[model samples]
Target: MKLRFPTATIAAVTFFASLAAGMTSPVLAEETASPTIVTNLRATPMVPANAPVRFAPPAEVVQTLSVVPAELTAADDSVTDSTTDFSTLDAAVAAQSAAIDDEELNCLAVSIYFESKGEPLAGQLAVADVILNRTTSGRFPSSVCSVVKQPGQFSFVKGGRLPDIDTSRRAWKTAVAVARVATKDLWQSPAKNALYFHARHVSPNWGKARVASVGNHIFYR
Candidate 1:
């Protein structure tokens, strides 16, 4: 134990010992090895299959909508106005006839006579007569009010507005009675199938076109 080693030999042994300790240490082993890399596959983005998509509308796309024709609407109006609940035009006229009186009938006859010996009493009645004549000729309304209020038929219609009648007037009462009689077909012999008429003084354009003449008036076919 007392023997001493050479100086060079001691130095070489010390260097080899330090190198072996460094190789066995955990810190040195970690610093000498290659670095590890990690990746997370779930962090990547993806599009859903049910996602909504945008697009421009077609230039010539076809569309559908509901509509009502004018003729169909008019037919509906006709059906509503002409309900078959009333038995006949005559029955309706008779029902309304009771509302008139003898005084009204005389006043109506006087007013009608002022126009002509056998003329209709009121303007409405005159129009009704014209319509009746047209009906018999197969060219006008068959009903009383329908004939009197025919579209564009009478000048007194005033833009197709029917005036509220003054039923309280003596002349109007007479006119109403006359209307009732005419509606009842009491004077059918006077203007049978006559569709045209004019005042006694003025010749009618329809005179030459006449089928007959009654009292001071001429009638047409």
Candidate 2:
């Protein structure tokens, strides 16, 4: 069978076909448009002017150190230092003779008693003078007890103590009298500036200035 269509119907059909093709062609062309490539590195995002920014607190900083007290440091320095003013032992002790008293006087008396009881009164006075000098001298201990008790320094000291002295003995009383007079400066020792002494029996060869000879002992500075 032959199919026939009117001209106006054919024209209408042609117009509808053209409209459909035009709409679909644009969509297909857009799908095949040039593509843009994205990179691994991205630019930093810009924050809006009014945006609230969040920030973590900076890491806490810590410091540790030990400090010493100034007073404690000073005390430590004083203990380790032994040096003092350089003054003549004779002049120093002579100026303060009364400092030797109380139990300290007894110590001086005992030292003189045991050391020079056999010698004359002058010898005992000289011994006491030597002890006082040593006390003032910075080279020896400052206290009378300390000077008398110093090891290997005095022949009378024994067992780190003075021997049992007989205070009742006349000799001891004489020694006490001598020590009192010497310390009180009532009588200046013949060995005025002497800080050392020894029995005449043996020479220490101290090679020092000889001050005086009293009884059996010779005194020197």
Candidate 3:
């Protein structure tokens, strides 16, 4: 004989079977859930090898710049010292005729006579000419004292022996004015390159070696 089970009992059995199959299935477990990963993103600074970097403190930059000007100034002073020569009033008169005056001419003559009397006329004029040559040479000082005081230049100045001039004297004033005129090149044909000069009576080695002769003096180029 055949027996029939209750409908409610059959339905409950079917539901339990389905639940057990789902729990044991690998495909169902993978499809149901997954773990999520989170990542953090932040900004970073990059430095270049050759790029100019700024200093943290601005005062340091200013200090570096300040030292540069002093260095440049020192270099310029060195150049000036090397190139410039100090000339005398006599040299100025020889170089620039316009700067010379009667007073300066007389003073130069007197100075020459005091120093060297053998060639009074030529020596005086020649000394004056030398002073003029130094004026425009650019190697010498632009002013009178500067040129006269040039180191190791003139014998008279070797031991720091400078002529004492009474500035208040009429002769001194005249000499100064003449020196100015001679330095300015006011008069021409006074002397040329007369670096070395001597009297007409005495034939020094320089006398024969001169490029030109003017008045009682022989001059060299």
Top model by lDDT, which number? 2
Compose the digit string of candidate 1's lDDT tens values, residues 39-83.
233355566999898785555442222355677667573354344
lDDT of 2 by residue, 40-147 (tens): 233546679999989855445222234556876775633432322314433333333233247788899888877788886667888999999999999999999998
For each candidate in turn, the TM-score is 0.39, 0.53, 0.36
Kindly provide the TM-score of model 2 when superposed on the true structure, using C-alpha atoms.
Answer: 0.53
Q: Write down the RMSD of all candidates, one decimal each.
A: 17.6, 18.3, 14.5
Candidate 1 lDDT (Cα, 0 to 1): 0.51
Clashes of each: 2, 0, 38
What's the lDDT for residue 164 in model 1?
Answer: 52
Q: Tens-digit lDDT track for model 3 on 135-213?
A: 5577676544555556775555545456655556544444444444434443443466654455567765643456666
Better of 1 and 3 by TM-score: 1
* Residue pairs with clashing backbones, model 2: none
Error of 1 at 146 (Å): 3.3
Residue 103 shift from truth in candidate 1, angstroms: 22
Q: Rank the candidates by lDDT, best first.
A: 2, 3, 1
